[model samples]
Target: MSVRELIVLGSASAVPTKTRNHNGYLLRWDGHGLLFDPGEGTQRQMTHAGVTASDLTWLCVTHFHGDHCLGVPGIVQRIARDGVAHRVDAAYPESGTVYWRRLRHAAAFHDTEVIREQPVSGEATRLDTGDAPFTLTARRLDHYVEAYGYRLEEPDGVTMLPAELAARGVRGPLVRRLQEDGAVTAPDGRTVTLEECSVRRPGQKVAFVMDTGLCPAVYELADGADLLIIESTFLDEDEPLALERKHLTAGQAAAAAAAGGVRHLVLTHLSERYGDADEERFLRQAAARFSGEITLVHDLDRVPVPRRRAVVRPRPAE
Candidate 1:
């Protein structure tokens, strides 16, 4: 079975509280793992969260914020220390090349694994890993610095119906032919079209938006995403402070999710002032604005992606 889930390694803002650490999230998508914004103490947080360096295929850094990207050196060091042979792709702002260089060589040990360094130069940058299930796109967000939001979109898939095939007497090579050609004539003189048997379902999509004020691309990247991991740093009462800092409050986050047509919203990067119960309240405020599933993420909390809704049977014309 393919597993898709988000592992919240840490979910604090600038400060680490007794329960929450800084910003760190791991997105496990089937065979690959994507780690985003590994803030301070991420190396230990990963250990506590039961996430291994070997599981990471991509490392996405939204910006050069210390609380967001401070763990880069540690991650690289750990990967090299573990002797994992797989090449890890690291994406961040191209302007941070100097910072990246400093971090990459920060107290380096014997380098073992290959780390591919790809940087985002401008707004609306797209990077193709060539073999992953989805394409990674980065769009600029409204922040004090050059911050970007990342989105991953998996390709659409076809679900084969056994009953439809059986009724057409289509089996073995004929079925494969129909799948590849979209239509095939059966052994019997009957013709089968792919559309007749299969339903058109959209592909699964996930977006990660952090440390940004409300922006149009935030909605663009998050639009109709199956899973959206967004930063909700403050409650609605602190909207002014959030706006001054170019951050999103819980209500704003929810509104963005609602506007973007997100199915599941995982809220993170919370202020330490909020208690556990307060987090729930803040999330509920967002939930009030958006009618989808909401998760108020905590350190080490795990959230599974909601399964896609089954195809709705079209009503026959009266």
Candidate 2:
């Protein structure tokens, strides 16, 4: 079975605490594992999470913050040392070209794995991830530094209904033919249309929004996201500080999730000031605004993408 989950490597913002590291996340999606915002100790965190450089297919950085991309050198070298067979894609804001280069080549290795450079520039647009099964889009976020948020969208497909098979007397290769051709001539010499049996299965979407204050881009990235992982660097009590630092508070993150119709909200990149004792307070603040599932991520915590929307079961054909 395929597994899709977001592993929280580190969850601290600005400062690392005894309980939390700087910032890091690994989003595991069917055959593709995305490493996002890999902080200073991300490599070790990955070791703890039972993941390795071999599991990384994409390295995504929201910006050039030390806590967000400092682990690039280690990750790159680790993959090189392990001789990762497939190509890995490193996607980040184009404005950080200088910083990216510095980290990419921070140390030299045999460099067996081919890491593709996919820099995000200009207005928000869908990035080219090279034959990826899903679409990867990015939007510029409002932050003190040049930053961007990313969204993943799977393609819509048709779900075949089992009851419809009996009704239409279509089975085996005929069913596949109906799906492929949208219409098929059955063994009984009857023409069947794909729509008569299947219903549209809307694709699933997941978004990542980090290190940005409340902005249109935040909502855009979160819109209809089945799972949205965003930075809630402060609590409502520190709204002014959050605004000054270009970070969102828990309440703001929840409000954006509600406004964007997000189904699952994960608030991370917490401030060191809020310890275990304050975790409930952050969740409560967000719960007051968003009715969906909320998770205040902890280091090494793995949160799966909620199951895809149920497939519609159309009535059997007469």
Candidate 3:
């Protein structure tokens, strides 16, 4: 069985507390893994989360903030140490090319894994390529520095129906024939169509928005997302501070999730001042606005994307 989940490595803001580290997240999607905002202690956090450098396929940085990207060097070095042969794509804001270069080569190691440095210079950049289920798109967000939010959307596909087979006397060879030919002629000369035996099922989508104040792009990228991982650095009471610092409060993040039709909202990037008491407040505020699943993420916690109901049709009658 395939698995898809977001592992929260660290969730603290600029300051780290006894409970929280910094900003680090590992999005595990089936065979691929996307590591985002690897903060200072991310290398150790990954161990606690049971993740290894070999599992990383992509390194995504919203900006060059030290708390958001300081662990890049350790991750790169570990990839070399483990001798991962597959290519790893690193995506970040183009304006921070100098910072990225410094962190990427912070320490020398055998360059076994080919690091594909993809800079997001403009809005709506497609960063990945392959026969993957979804396409990754990045959009600029409102931040003090250059920052971007990312969305992953899967392709739609047709779901086959077993009940429709028996109804049309389509069984055995006729099943394969109908699938290939779209229409199969029965023994009695009756024609069965593929359209009658299948239904189009839309694939799920996931988005990540961090280190940005509430903006239009945030809603755009999060629209209809099955899972939305957003930074909620402050509680509702601290909205003023959030706005001033170009960050998002819990209420704002939840409101954006509600506006975007997000099914599951995972809030991270918490301030250390509130501690355990803060999670309830954040959850209450979010639940008040968004009527979906909400998770106040903790360091090394794994949150899975809520799966949509699989399309099913009645099997064909005899």
Candidate 4:
């Protein structure tokens, strides 16, 4: 089935290196393709990663930093060039509308005119797509610029148990009716209720936090998320630089993930000075702070969302 994974197109922080391009990530959530922070060369990076313009459904910019949003013009133009008929929603800080306009038309081809401007205003607010089952929201983060983090949370659903239905003599289309109507009469003339055959299943949740220092919203966005993609711009040795630049060290990011109860942490936006081989240091730093799964996001890396934990909240008391 349903595909849920993140595709890292680029993972460099502040500057691009020979190997790392810039900050760019794509979260493939079923029918949704949320592209985050299309920095320079993101178009080429996407091509290398086997991601296409047609794959994008939303473009989210964390801030106006060039390394974070420079590829906006290219992304908009390429999607239009490929004749993307569907409207793509673009979200960014509302105060940066001028910069957005500059990037939107940096170089105009035939404008598809399908890009919806869903800007994030002051404070944390929902960017209601009115389509996806999960609610999408952006919360302001602590950074040198106006940056925001994104989160998606699906509502809890009922998981029907076949054994429970069979014991109740609910079979065939009657079971479907019971699910849809929450109750139905089987051929045995007994009323079967959906609650008797189903258990509550907690919905999956994921969050993206980038280009920010230690902040309250970082934990807010990552709170109880199944997967969290966050910026780890420097190692602890560079804590001074991180604080000066309003960026997070690997340890800080991992601590935030741990505090937020994130199941999987994918660390990105690494400094180019750190080699791929040196990535293990970041991993070890995160491991020291968080017990859950940790990843050092690299170019073209794909991280699948962790499976939902089965909820037993309403189980009958022993």
lDDT for each of the candidates?
0.88, 0.90, 0.88, 0.90
User: If scored against the real structure, what TM-score would every candidate get?
Assistant: 0.95, 0.96, 0.93, 0.96
Model 2 residue 257 lDDT score: 96
Model 1 C-alpha lDDT per residue in residues 1-318, reported as the tens digit of each score: 788999998999988899999889999998799999999999999999888999999999998989998998899998998987888999998988888888888894887547898899777988968788888999999998888899999877777788878998889998889889999998888889987767666788999999999989889988989999999999998999999999999989989899988999988898887888796688678978999999887789989988865464465699
TM-score of 4: 0.96
The window of 10 residues in a row where model 3 has the poorest summed lDDT is: 307-316
After the best TM-score superposition of candidate 4, give how far the Cα of residue 73 lies from its true spot, in angstroms: 0.5
Write down the lDDT that model 4 would get: 0.90
Model 1 residue 285 lDDT? 88
lDDT of 3 by residue, 5-72 (tens): 98999989889899999899898888889999999999999999889998998899999888999999
Give the Å shift of residue 219 in candidate 3.
0.5
Clashing residue pairs in candidate 4 (N, C-alpha, C atoms within 3 angstroms):
none
Predict model 3's lDDT versus the native: 0.88
Candidate 3 lands at a TM-score of: 0.93
lDDT of 2 by residue, 1-318 (tens): 788999999999988999998888888888899898888999999999999888999999999999899989999999999889898988999999999999998976776548988999876977776777789998999998999999999888888888887888999998888889999887788898998888888788999999997888999999999999999988899999999989999999999999999999999999888779999999999999999999999999999998778577655599
Residue runs of model 2 more than 4 Å from their true location after superposition: 311-318
Worst 10 residues of 1 by lDDT: 307-316
